[model samples]
Target: MELRPWALLLSLLLLPSLALAAGKCERLVITGSPDAPPLLWRDPQDPTHLIGATADVLQQVAKDLGVKIDLLYGGTRSLALDEVRSGRMDILADAPLNLGELDNLDYIHPALVQTDYLVWTRKDSTLAYATAGDLQGLKGAVSERARLTPAFDTFATQHLNLQRLPTLTPVFQKLLLGEVDYVLAGRYSGMALAQTLGMSNDLIAHDTPIDQPGLYLAISHNSACNDPWLRGQLAKKMTELAGSGVAQAALQRNLERWKAQLQQPVGTQTK
Candidate 1:
């Protein structure tokens, strides 16, 4: 009887620790686009890392989950996706839901946020923009890495005159110089970049969103940390954060942060 009591006590102690070890990962490595601002962008001082609203949201989730996360710059968006796909990185901080990626990653449901991609044009342009159809035959530019929407992608490929550029800045610059009729870009990111380039007065994002794709936190299928427990916890926390307006607040806060960083003379660097 005495041994049984001692054994029960030992079992109680070991159970919790075993469960914790099984259910939780100590650290997760995450990566995302370096040029996506308000959502995420390269840290000027540390080119290896990324910072912005999505990064902040992930950090907050990590805090709540009691895990350490590293948000690194893994080259271009495609390269970042490749890193996660290769399982070299554990998580992708900002991922768009795509049927192709479903094979490689498990995307957390309820999405972190829906990014509104807007049609941007020179403020003086007489572009009557109400629908994607209005942009038919019009010259447009978007980042080569952008995932607007499946339907929009199909429509653009067949009907729209869209050029895939390497980055957003040059796309907007092309709009200013009249090389392109308009550019498709994220609302807040476009605003932040335009203000940073001092082109806020010259550029305008249409109220109608061309595409509003949900940005998700996706875990690589190949990651050592890829488990049901971590995915469930992240999904639960994301649901809470989405309803609490933390993501939106982070977006607004980082929008200003990006602009402020660019205002510095030595801070004009970006990856």
Candidate 2:
């Protein structure tokens, strides 16, 4: 048998090229608010680590797509949105569209979650009212930099007593201490926080919903992975994840656990 010199040389030259071409892509950077509990938050034991509902769901999506995720912690909504907009991050989970326009960014249809804005007040507080207008005469608290839905914005504009805080925790604290007559909060987040702080018994959320918005995964427009083909592939993978009942089941379980925790006696504390 005779070995061909030309074939041997060609194989030697192409092997390295093939290996380089097949090298794995960079880790997908997912930016999220560290204080947004149950959706996205830093791991207590490991502050550098990020974990929550959105983290769990995104991990499942990445697993299905055979990609790696590098969770990045952005403590504020603005910071998280900035990271995605500046191309420093690949995706933002559980973000409201009111935060920014997605003309350049691509979004997944059928959002993973829906959020509602609501009012919270002390259980025995004499605040008796309905609609955002009812707060005109009383002091109210809300997220400082948060961009409320159009309706909420309009209502806030007409009311002059609204005081905006930087984060939800502080707003809840203010409400508990009677610093503010009421605090506007996102339903799920407020519930989670109330349970975590052992304040569910002291505070009660109003039945009226101020607004409801779908939460989406916003993919950066500048990402090299952004394109019709990549979008389609990701969408297909997400659909598969949803269809497998894994995401839904996990969501259900988390919701039930949170609910049970909320139902427990107020003195039951958690770290």
TM-score of each: 0.86, 0.71
List clashing residue pairs in candidate 1: none
Q: What is residue 183's positional error in candidate 1, in angstroms?
A: 1.5
lDDT of each: 0.88, 0.73
TM-score of 1: 0.86
Going through the candidates in order, what is the number of backbone clashes in each? 0, 0
Candidate closest to the true structure, highest TM-score: 1
**Candidate 1 residue lDDT tens string, 101-172:** 899999999888888899999988999999989999789999876767787788889999999998888888
Top candidate by lDDT:
1
